[model samples]
Target: MSVSTETRIKWTSADLELLPENGNNYEIIDGELYMTRAPHWKHQTSIARITNALVSWSNQSKLGQTIINPGIIFSDDNNVIPDLIWISNKKLESCVDEAGHFTSAPELVVEILSQKPNDIKRDKETKLKLYSNRGVREYWIVDWQLKQVEIYRRYEGKLTLMITLLDDDSITSELLPNFSCQIRDFFL
Candidate 1:
């Protein structure tokens, strides 16, 4: 198949109102529209594992809630469907609008990189910069290929590399306070 080189059509959060309910993941980054195909089985499994771990911790602590594929609008031109979003209980109401979408940045955004080269590159570079610039408290990049998870936390006004965990290591969040999971478990 030939790779398309056409520039994407510009879009805003308002444009999402016209879109029908579909399996395709629609997002807008810096005013450009991007449509991602449904995730593969391994990708879905990894997401589920992370969600499972977060759910257990959040439930017991009453710290917050973990949601899958929530529309997070950082700006009119920057709308994204994160793989998993965590909102702390304190700011959940203020962040989420009446439409059940987050109008502001969530505390944490998790992205499980796919096997596709374009997506892999975008998550590591482009999205990392976007989330950091938008003031997301933490960002997690999960790489099944390398069996590792990279956590970035806001520090000194920029997102800084907090920790890089291998499959054998566990992810612990000081913000979450007692929340953790084995990196290997997230892949399984």
Candidate 2:
């Protein structure tokens, strides 16, 4: 009798370079490759609104920087492009690499959930675990379709579910001092 074994390919950041710029988003989580097509218009709008709020606050506070769709490379096999990220000036200096990608975790990471079930799972479960394990201080999962935001804050050395804000409610962050916005703003 002959014994055969199957070998699975563990994707890495190097493999991402081989893919064409085809208007799709690709990420490697735990050595697995996940891809999604371009997001919907509402998704883009939500990002814009969130960016505007974060950027405005960051500019005034001068405490950190807010960026959209930055490639955060925790490792060769654990890289992701989050919807948005806000990193303190101190942490940014330490985590950013010469290639201009974040080599480590940021202060905060945000993900605007897409319509697809897989994408939703990636944000809420897979990426949540990845960010928590890698020491991200805060993580926000925004569901524009539902007009809600789930905020996770670092607690006892891990990201913990702190609160969920509905459309009528406002959102605030301890990581970002004095930063507040209504949940409805994200949908608008």
Candidate 3:
């Protein structure tokens, strides 16, 4: 929502550029400025654990490159940052802009869900719809509190539930063969 002190100013991708690097996350949705609070250490721990495994798989298989917190101008009015994105080398070479934003959607985006209510709702609904419509093929929502990951894949241009991975399950992407890890590691 509109929380910026600069009242009545519409937030845009260009406006996001004007923000100082103040260790805060700013996102815009439908012309509203959403100032996201910094996440807790638990969030960082989960991300680090999962990223380590992803890096290992990517390096071993040469599948692609993984980036953290990629700034993307999804639309003229939506300039949100995703937590982690894995882009196939082919897409990376062709779609990465001079400013480092990916004009083309990444193959996969991983969102580490926070305890905050808005964060949960936005990740499950807002981001799911946004990324899916933007052509992100795979979306993974990681919930440390639940110790699970929900995978949504693009099917016929709509997001469909691909899988719900629990702690005991080995998480694998049907889209990315040979890339997988134990689901519980994400919470550790």
Candidate 4:
């Protein structure tokens, strides 16, 4: 699981403090700082499409607020930057921390899987379990390469695959009530 990169920096709260207020994104996983180079064009397109769809649905229907690329602090030492998160306003207010960690997990978290094989595996399996254990009721994994989005639902203390949505299909989340997205818009 290690990429053996010499240029990487170890992460700490100080490093987090030192980050510029610029729009660049970073995630701290177990004391390792993982900085994102700008996501590719297709990735950005997909991200925007999903964010727009979720926000529109949530706002009009009153399911929850659509949060885009916010820092989700999983622990004192672990901070995650999810691509999209949908949290009820009540949840958002209750979860804010003095240092800006999301103390509470969102009801739905969406991760757009990168093309790298390690990333694909990490998002599909490791992150899915992590979110489920952390009480995210719905986890969506969007695979650009595969042209599919896998929706996972937490049931009876475990997460099970609810559906694999193809490009022509429309997918919705149970946690957010009426939030839905067209599958093709994500890949287009």
Candidate 5:
């Protein structure tokens, strides 16, 4: 009888740079690597709708910037490209590095759920815990198929589910003052 020992490879930000410039999306979470193919048309449309709303609000408020598919590098071992991110000008100045990658958590991170089971898990469970632990003030999980948005706000030092806005309801964030959008807008 023989005993075998196996060591898992821990991925880092540097490893991501070496990948081919294909359309695939790759992320390193807790030193593990995860990949996803290009998003569907519906996903892209939802992102566009959400981005437009956030951009319009931010422009008037002059509070921060709404970025689409920004690379948020929380650590060498935890680099993720969220669907969208909203970072205040104050926090943005400190978190963004010379390379234009966020070195810390943004004020709000938005992720659109895919139909794939693994992708859904990565967004809901893996990324939820990651964002909560890393001090993301707010997180939104947008489900296109279900046409709902799950909002998580930081409470008691952890991201807690505050609400789920249905198509009939409007989505609002405490992090974004005076910002509200009809949930139906996301699908349309």
Candidate 6:
């Protein structure tokens, strides 16, 4: 099977406008449209575990709302579909667009790295940089296979890898007060 090269895909705001109302999982980065199929069972399991934990915490407290696999527009023409996003209600209300574009950056974003070589590299390096440069306060890179999570926080005008948690270590977010999850539980 041949994947479409970036040059072959022409991206525009109008193109994004034509996406189905039901919504499809896609992202446009630098005008290169990337279509993602449903993740594998292992990936979905990990995501469910992590998302459930965040949802529980967010629900009880007013920390933020955890949205899973939502369409997020990063720029006028750059759209990104993050695995998860935590946006304060204030941010969510203010960033609204009828056309599905988010006018503001998310406070926290999570990207679960897939086993595919191309995806792994892009999630770790490229998307990591893009989210940070766009002023996302905290970014979490979840490595399901390794059972590890890398936490990155913006600091001094750059995104720095603050720590990597493994096994039973609890992953806490500086962006969301009192938000946490045990790394081991993320795999369950």
Clashing pairs in 1: none
What are the per-residue Cα lDDT tens digits for candidate 3 across 1-188? 67757557777888877988898898886777777778978887888887788888889889798788888776768877888988888888888678878776889999999888988888899888888888999999998888999999999997878889999999888767877788988886
Superior by lDDT: candidate 4 or candidate 6: 6
Candidate 3 backbone collisions, by pair? none
The candidate, 4 or 6, that scores higher on TM-score is 6
Local accuracy of candidate 4 as per-residue lDDT tens digits, 79-162: 788888889877877998896658778988899987767666767776676787789888888887778998888888877788
TM-score of each candidate structure, all chains considered together: 0.90, 0.96, 0.90, 0.82, 0.97, 0.87
lDDT of 6 by residue, 6-86 (tens): 546568556866777553466777676766666778887888898898889889887678888777777755788888888
Q: What is the C-alpha lDDT of each candidate?
A: 0.87, 0.93, 0.84, 0.78, 0.94, 0.81
- Per-residue lDDT tens digits for candidate 2, residues 145-165, read 889999999999999999999
Q: Candidate 3, which segments miss by more than 4 Å at Cα?
A: 1-10
For model 2 the TM-score comes to 0.96
Residue pairs with backbone overlap in model 2: none
Better of 4 and 5 by lDDT: 5
Alpha-carbon deviation at 116 in model 3, angstroms: 1.0
The superposed Cα distance between candidate 4 and the true structure at residue 36, in angstroms, equals 2.9
lDDT of 5 by residue, 1-188 (tens): 99999999999988998999888999999999999998889999999999999999999999999999999888899999999999999998888789899899989999999989999999999999999999999999999999999999999999999999999998888889999999999996
lDDT of 2 at 114: 96
Total backbone collisions for each predicted model: 0, 0, 0, 0, 0, 0
- Which residue runs of candidate 2 sit more than 4 Å off their true CA positions? 1-4
lDDT of 4: 0.78
> Which number leads on TM-score?
5
Clashes of 5: 0
Which ten contiguous residues of candidate 3 have the minimum total lDDT? 1-10
Superior by lDDT: candidate 3 or candidate 6: 3
Q: Is candidate 5 or candidate 6 better by lDDT?
A: 5
Candidates 1 and 6, the one with greater TM-score: 1
